[model samples]
Target chain A: MLLEVSAEKRFGNFLLDAEFALDCKRCGIFGPSGSGKSTLVHMLAGLLKPDRGKISIAGTPVFDAARGINIPPEKRRVGLVFQHSHLFPNMSVQANLYYGWRRTRKSDRKIGPGALTTALNLDHLLKRDVNSLSGGERRRVAVGRTLLACPRLILLDEPLTGLDAELKSQIMPYLKKVFTEFDVPMLFISHSLQEMRLMTDEVLIPENGCCRKRMSTEELARSSMTSVPRSYVNLLTLRRPQAHNDIWIYSWGDEKLRLIEPGEPGDNLFELGASDITLFKRHPEATSARNILPCKVVEIFGSGGRVGVELEGGGGRLVSQIVHESVRELDIQNGSELFAVIKASAFRKIC
Target chain B: MLLSPQDMQAVWLSIKVATTATLVTAPFGFGIAYFFSFARMPGKYLLECLVNLPLVLPPVVVGYLLLLFFGQSGFAGPLLKFFDLRIIFTLTGAVIASAVVGFPLLVRAIRIGMDNIDIHYIQAARTLGAGRLDTLLTIILPLSGRAILAGMTLMFARSLGEFGATIILAGNIPGVTQTIPLAIYDYANTPDGDRMAMSLCLVSIALSFAVLLASEALARSFRKGSADAP
Candidate 1:
């Protein structure tokens, strides 16, 4: 199904001028915090009215402010799993499931209880009170309840936010299974790139209050095509050079120069890492490494058994992490006279 | 001591009043709560304030207000007259008073319960293709049992102890219009019936205690559910 949303809304100082069509079965709505991702979902689900726009899913008109046509959430056939799963407290897992079942009109023409509940592993929890279920289990039941309604489209609004990482990992497979098993298309919202990787193939990144662009997660993650992966972006190693659109240009070797896109013109940042590099880093002695001045090894930092070496590259700061074993075997020290490797391929196409 | 016919009449009347008030207002009360909690409506704030008015209004004023409307030649008097009905100073009038006083409490408790509910479930249900009323009847209602039950208890307690409004609108007519609270008031006014008044006092206290206990229990469970679900 193709879901379209074009709207204008303002929440206090936050303005939302977003428009996007999601064609993928599973797509991620990605953005930094307060990027209007949830606002977009709210508009889709009929929870919030847009000032102007038309939203249609598979040609069903969900919203059209100009025409004054706004479908109520239930009629829109858009299921939403919230950041917080709002299971009905008074009902048992079984009752909650049945609640969704009873609301469906068989004549409206799709799905059955047995298929949905069994798919979500809600059968065992059916008899249990919703209050007694664990967070993970409640989410499962909530998803089950929504699916049992047999919606045409599903929207998950940061559905895994309060979950611990382990819980998130544990539930990730079930979410994948639910997506595939239920045959329902979904819009998954996430702020973390790590989470976006596990959830969807298509990624829609929201910047400011609007969607900047949409692409495949792989394409999004690739260093050359996109700057999604931290390991992919180019890190400038020169002491100083010309600045362009907040990007700094640095010579890697005689021929290879890389661009470091640092966002807007005025913002300044200190200390960058090779892991933060989107593309490549290399150290060369050419008349080209001519710009590469003498450097100094500064410090090393890592977590959970990894090591990152800090260096002063020709008076400019650069960082590259090494395996603990590498640091030990290579005799790398605080003042080691090793080159801070820089590469040309490390430059990513930042849109 | 053996049960007296007066006590029996009062007990029966109390049940009748409480049951009728609950039966008539529950579906509407829950519906109002659901709407107030979830729906985007024009004049919703006005409606919310109206629904909650009784909670803050003195029961006597509420009774007085009902009397103004339901009394003979009053605003609604002619409408009920079409059916040969009279509300003032009758058992039905007592119910009207009880229900009015209890309604705000019932709706507030239920609304708060519903407000605490994540609209996600309903949204999920909608996507699942359930219609508006269907979601309300099934998921919303069943899921909010604790809050609704709490509302029910509050309504019953308020109705049982209802005096100011019941006395004003329905008046105290022993064995008919006189509920337990009214009965207690009448007996306690007489020198020889002090013991009877004390007995009624003990009964009201006990029932209120029972309702309070049930309220606490439901509240505890409500908290447990909130913690588990999100």
Candidate 2:
């Protein structure tokens, strides 16, 4: 894991109790205002100490209350990009960029100034006074400064909050480009679902101050979080563009993906929640449907006409829903190829 | 009339004393002001009251208090003397008295400035990987520049017109510790030379007004820039 944190802190009347782990990958902090999101990020970066609990980055203990280890911010190889930009007005943009870069110990340094400045398009901005830079430009500079610090993980606290919507879009692409080009893990903090959806795949959802649950970006997008578990799906999960990050990764209603070399097959890369599919008995053959996994009505569950059916598609079992009336009328018992009809469009690529 | 050598010396000495006092005490005053406005330290209220004591106390009382601690046999008497420092009956002592009297106003201005500053800015700095000191130097201080400038100007104006403390500590030595306020007092004390005193009074008002205007203008411009900055 790139970062692991469990902390509880109090400021004024607000209480911050947050805990989560990110496996050396980009993750996001999503919560509403006063949800202790900023406080969580601050604690991760060693900017604020927790009254209880512990935090570590790559197994390096940052703050451990019982062990009595509190690493200072400068010593923690965690970079933070504040929502407010925090540029040094007295210095030029170049000076602000170099501020943290200069503090990095020689042996541990990774990304250098020239490379980061070029990547972030900071060469032209170096001459401008930090106070003179616009919000977007200041944010870019702030991100670059942190990157140049050669940190193990980056912490961004609602980096887009102060900017206008258009300017936020302008800076969003740069952040994506940076994330793609560089290997550094980042913990993006934002209450806006739209912003979180656009930037990160791994989401840590907060209940009060603590992370109550975790969901992939695709799950978060599809579920918009409703109480009911969508509906019992009765078709094969399709492989398509709507299931992944932006374009979508084809996911199955039954969980079988029709694709080639999915790379490092982790169980979490795909999930066919028994709720998103519709099943049909008559096998309509000529549709542009790329996947036609065969399933039998093993059992039926749910009430008032709607029923969930269990299916065995390619060793991995899945459940689908068929109406109670259809279940009784078709006499679709243990072994019948109830044609699972899933549109390739319905499959969202979430990985 | 072209200014005489003694008049020119008084002007030079006044400038030097005011500048030295303003620069020397500025950072300490900012620290005190920030502590008073933001920190949760114990005895904060008492500390604030002590800092503002100079504003209500007579300038000579301030000077005598400085003498009680900084004089030949005062609290800091031996400590200062250990460094071959003698504040009694010197221009340095005059600067000390003026700084003490001016400190309350300086801190008051800075404290208000610190209060007016948005705490969000500081929190934002912390999220930017800036440690406490870096945030202070880079974020807090620059943002607080207008306040610092205002405090310095206020202190200078008070020091230029300061008389009671200067006379007691520095013994009113002409062309040395005799600032504009001391010089004005001396000229007015003479039987028939009110012109010099009136002229000095006019200059003091002009100087004070100029500093006040400049600081306000700078502060307004700074706030405007922050607002317009994207």
Q: What are the per-model C-alpha RMSD values against the true structure?
A: 12.6, 7.3
Q: Write one digit per residue (lDDT tens) for candidate 2, span B1-230.
A: 63456666777788788888898899899998878887887888988999999899888887777777777777888888789987888889888988888988899988887786666556545544567887777767776777777788889888887877778878788876878777777787898658766766676777778778877888786663333233
Candidate 1: list runs displaced more than 4 Å.
Answer: A91-130, A138-150, A177-184, A223-229, A233-351, B2-4, B39-68, B79-82, B210-228
Q: What is the RMSD of candidate 1?
A: 12.6
Docking class of 1: acceptable
Best of the candidates, DockQ:
1
Candidates in order have lDDT scores of 0.72, 0.72
- State interface RMSD in Å for all models: 3.6, 3.9
Q: Please state the error at residue A137 of candidate 1 in Å.
A: 4.0
Instruction: Please give the C-alpha DockQ score of model 2.
Output: 0.25
Candidate 2: C-alpha lDDT? 0.72
